[model samples]
Target chain A: AQRVTQPEKLLSVFKGAPVELKCNYSYSGSPELFWYVQYSRQRLQLLLRHISRESIKGFTADLNKGETSFHLKKPFAQEEDSAMYYCALFNDYKLSFGAGTTVTVRA
Target chain B: NAGVTQTPKFRVLKTGQSMTLLCAQDMNHEYMYWYRQDPGMGLRLIHYSVGEGTTAKGEVPDGYNVSRLKKQNFLLGLESAAPSQTSVYFCASSSPGTSKNNEQFFGPGTRLTVL
Candidate 1:
């Protein structure tokens, strides 16, 4: 079965600190990975995709096939960066998502 | 463009009641999806449509029904509401293929609570 796992349920980081949210996925075939974010009172939206290889909002996720991971990383955390992040995998024309990690950047 | 829009931003229902959540997209996307978000359980796909008049069961389709009679609209119906079904429902639409389709534009979401 194809599944995405985000080990952290709640992650707290101090402002200006480096933050990393772990995401691991299991799939039988080549995978396309993505990161989706939802901020308070805002609609869920795409943060980045592995195919694009581009960073969004100062965050970047590298798809590591050898380790079956696609972890999201940010060098400096900001209060505005606090939000829910979901790692997803495109499987058989559908996207499978992880349980999500909520990041809270403390002032 | 409105992108994706879901009706009834907030709804409350008693057990056994029925309701339909409407999703409309102006992007002319060929794919539409319905998902429920619960604490600790991210977004679970309830139902999706690849195109008009073609609906498919997703990761979690039980107790839910979907229709995509119109290309721009997708409807999710809960035959009999249950407390277990209480969650925030989101609607999204995407174009076909693997490249640009990776981006699924989402609606503001509907918060459904069943007592």
Candidate 2:
């Protein structure tokens, strides 16, 4: 079975600091990875995909096959970056999502 | 475009009551899905429709029924509501089976509580 794991349930960082949300997956075959975000009082939206290889909102995730991880990272965290982040794995036509990590940026 | 929309943004039902959640998409997507969101459980797929008039069971399909009578609308019905069914329901749509990568578009979600 395919599974997505996001170890941290909540992460806190000061504004302007670097942020990293750990995500790991276990799948039998090559997998497609994605990062989804949900801001306060807003619907969940796609943040980025590994296949696109593009960065969104200063956040980027690189699929590390050797480590079985696709951690989301940002150089400088902003107050607006505080939101819930979910890592997902696409298997055929279905998607498996992680438990999600809530990032809190404080001044 | 509204993208994906779910009806009855909020609802509270007594046990044994029945209701249906409607999801509509204007993007002409071929794939539609219903999922329940719970704390520490993430999103669990309840039912899905690959195309018009086609419905399939997902990871957690028990106690739920779904239908896709039209190309743009998918309905998820709970015949008898239970306390365990209380969760935020999300509807998503994507153009898959034809597109290389399936990027799903999500709805605002419906908050359902069964007491």
Best by DockQ: 1
lDDT of 2 at B46: 93
TM-score between model 2 and native? 0.97
Q: Give the interface RMSD of each candidate.
A: 0.8, 0.7
Q: Would you list the clashing residue pairs of candidate 1?
A: none
lDDT of 1 by residue, B71-101 (tens): 9999999999999999999999898765677
**Which stretches of candidate 1 lie above 4 Å from their native place?**
none
True contacts kept of 2: 0.66
Model 2 regions lying over 4 Å from their true place: B97-100
lDDT of 1 by residue, A3-101 (tens): 999999999999999999999999988998999999999999999999899999999999899999999999999999999999999876588999999
Candidate 2 chain A weakest ten by summed lDDT: A88-97
Report fnat in order of the candidates: 0.83, 0.66
